[model samples]
Target: MDAFFASVEQLDHPEYRGKPLAVGGNRERGVVAAASYEARKFGVRSAMPSRLAAQKCPNLIFVPPRFDRYKEISRVIRKIFLEFTDLVEPLSLDEAFLDVTNNHFAFPYATQIAKAIRHRIFLETGLTASAGISYNKFLAKVASDLNKPNGQAVIPPEKAEAFLEKLPIEKFFGIGKVTAEKMKALGIHCGRDLKAYSLVFLTRRFGKSGRHYYDIVRGIHESEVKPDRIRKSLGVENTFEKDLLTSSSVAETLTNKILPEFFRRLQQSQTAGRTLTLKIKYNDFTVHTRSRTFPEAIPPGSMEALALELIRQEELSGPVRLLGISLSNLIRPDDPGRQLRFSY
Candidate 1:
């Protein structure tokens, strides 16, 4: 999907069409969850602060997120994908990777499968989609972004190496802003530059991920797309309009706002975990975390108690800006004694 959340909003609200629009933020506070192409022209982007977005595109319209509606549309899109191949690995509500090696339509070419899927999605959902067809996941993911809204790109195996060699290090998937900067500092500016380093050298420089960098530059990603990707953790976090100035205020916010939302998501996922983590972001944009793990899935009432305990243990370094609660070390359905027993 293209500008998924913002596109959906435009689909439902015709007045927003062709206008710079954003979803999930207000002019005064919050962050831009998605930005339409019109908004992007003015340097507006997803995850940008709403205030900065407004300053970038003064005419940008902000709309609250309707996740239920987005999910409904996502389900419809997934159904379309299943029509082509059962081997669909969803990255999020709006993006997925489909292994069409043996598709339901008996299509010999993955490109054909991509075109069919994109067409079906547009027909069923009235939205545009982009696709990247390639021999492997890494090249496919990178190819997917080469074209813009309603376009598709492909990188055959023969051309993968040359394409990767010229590609900027920053454009590679899994290389974030910080990692890209680190690579640049090491005189690694492109895939070709990265490929010049030995496996041992890369591993020494980048730790475990150095091997990944070495392999991907030479078009050597062998990881298969797993359709049933298990979620590792579930969390909820909130940024306050005003910084929380005291521990008492932080506790009050947790009691009244954060904890309820976290538990609601945990229940909705129908899963539990043994570890509870508390994440804090201070006004200076620095972050810290504390966690506790139990012998079994955390019991009812324990998450709240543990979260508060974690908060109390950490002396506030500065006025707090955000707080998050997460559960990890999940109790999977196949795990023995998976049933969660609640106790006060």
Candidate 2:
């Protein structure tokens, strides 16, 4: 799916086509959920503050997100994926990993399978999707994004090492802003730079994830794509239009705004969990997360009290930019005492 949320908005509202448009955000504190290519040309992007997006593109049109419609279209796309292989691992509603090694049609090449799936998606949903076909998930995910909206890229096994060696550190999956900066400070700018470090040296510098970095840089990712992945946690979050100035305001938003939405989703999913986690992002973009796990499930009515307690436990660090609440260690009705999680 290309610019998924905004694309859906354009598809339903013909007037928005070819215009600078975005989904999510208001003129104030909200963030952009997705931006059209037209908006992207103006340097607008998802997770960007609405005020910043406006500054970047003065004529940017912000449409409220219609998640239900997007999910409906996503279902159509997933069905198309299943036609080729049952080993489809969805990263999000709009992106997935399909292990077409043993596809239903006995296709000899993954690129052929990718093209057929992309064609079917456009035929069925009237939307375009880009694909990356490779021998592993890391290369495949990176390749997919190389070509944007209605394009495909392939990286054969033989080309993986040379391709990775020249790739920038920031472009590698699983490396965040802080890690990228840390690598830069260490004079590591590309995969070749990263590969020069020993496993022991990287682990000492980057904690447990350093080993992951060491391997992925050398083209050593061996993770398999599994089908029917189970979700580990579910949550809702919001960025405030105005900085939350006090604990009372934060508590109010958590109970009045965030909790109701969270519980509604919980009820819809019919899932419960023993752990409740609260995430707070300061105005400076620094984040803090606190969690509480219980032997028994916390009742819905008690959630507000627990959430408030969690908020109070933290120092009123700075005016909060964003607040979120989630439930993890989930137990679904059909899977008792079973917990499954996804790692990206």
Candidate 3:
């Protein structure tokens, strides 16, 4: 999908179409969850601070997120994907990977399957989608971004090496901004530069991920398209308009705000966890985290107490700007040995 959340807003509200629009944020606080192409031209982008986004695009319009509506549309899109291929791996509400090697229509070309899927999505949802057709997930993911809005690109196997050699290191799928900077510092500015290093040298420099860097540059990614991807954790966080000045206020927010929302999501997902983590961001923008693991899933009644304990255990370095709680070491209902025991 193209600028998915913002695009959805444009589809439902004609007034927002073809304008600089953002979904989720305000002029005063919060973060931009998505930015329309119009806003992107003015340097507005998702995850940018709302204040900064406003400065970048004076005419940018901000709208609150409607996740339920997005999910509804996402389900419709997924249904279309399933009609073509059962081997579909969803990365998020707006993106997915479809292995069309043996599609329902038996299409000989993956490019044709991609075109058909995008067309079906636009027809059914009144939204535009882009696609990347390639022989592997890495190249496919990279190719997907080459085209914008309603376009598609393909990277055939024979051309993969030459194509990657010229591609910037920053353009690789798994390389983040921080990693790219680190690579650039070491004269690894492009895929060709990275390919010059030996496997042993890369592994030594990048630790376990060095091997990943080495393989991907050579167009070697063995990861399969997992149709059923298990979620590892569930969390919620809130950035405050004013910094929390005291431990008491932090504890109050945990008891009244954070834990309640976390529990609601956990119940909705019908999953439990044996580890509880506390994440804190200070006014200085530094982060700290603490976690406690139990022998069994933490009961609903014990959640508040455990959350409070986690907060009280640490002293505030300064005024706090954000607070979050998460549950990990998940126990889904279908997992083996799924007995719940009280160990706290």
Who wins the TM-score comparison?
A: 1
Q: What are the lDDT figures for the candidates, one per model?
A: 0.91, 0.89, 0.91
N/CA/C clash count, model 1? 0
* TM-scores, one per candidate: 0.96, 0.91, 0.95
Order of the predicted models by lDDT, top scorer first: 1, 3, 2
> Backbone clashes in each candidate structure, one number apiece?
0, 0, 0
Please, what are the lDDT tens digits per residue for candidate 2 over residues 1-344? 78999988999999999999989888766889999999999999998888899999989999999989999999999988998899999999999999999999999988888889988988888889999988889999889889998999998889999999999999999998889999999999999999999999999999999889988887778989978688899899988778898999999999899999998888787767889999999888889999999986666667778999999996788999899999998776777654433111
Q: Which residue pairs does candidate 1 place in steric collision?
A: none
> What tens digits encode model 3's per-residue C-alpha lDDT throughout 1-344?
99999999999999999999999778987789999999999999898989999998999999999999999999999999999999999999999988889899989999888899999999999999999988889999999999987999999989999999999999999999999999999999999999999999989988999999999998988888889988899999988878899999999998889888887887788778989999999977789998999988888778788888988897889999889999999887887887643432
Give the CA lDDT, 0 to 100, for residue 287 in model 1: 91
Extract clashing residue pairs from model 3: none
Query: Model 1's lDDT to the true fold?
Result: 0.91
Q: Root-mean-square deviation of each candidate, in angstroms?
A: 1.5, 3.7, 2.0
Q: Is candidate 1 or candidate 3 better by TM-score?
A: 1
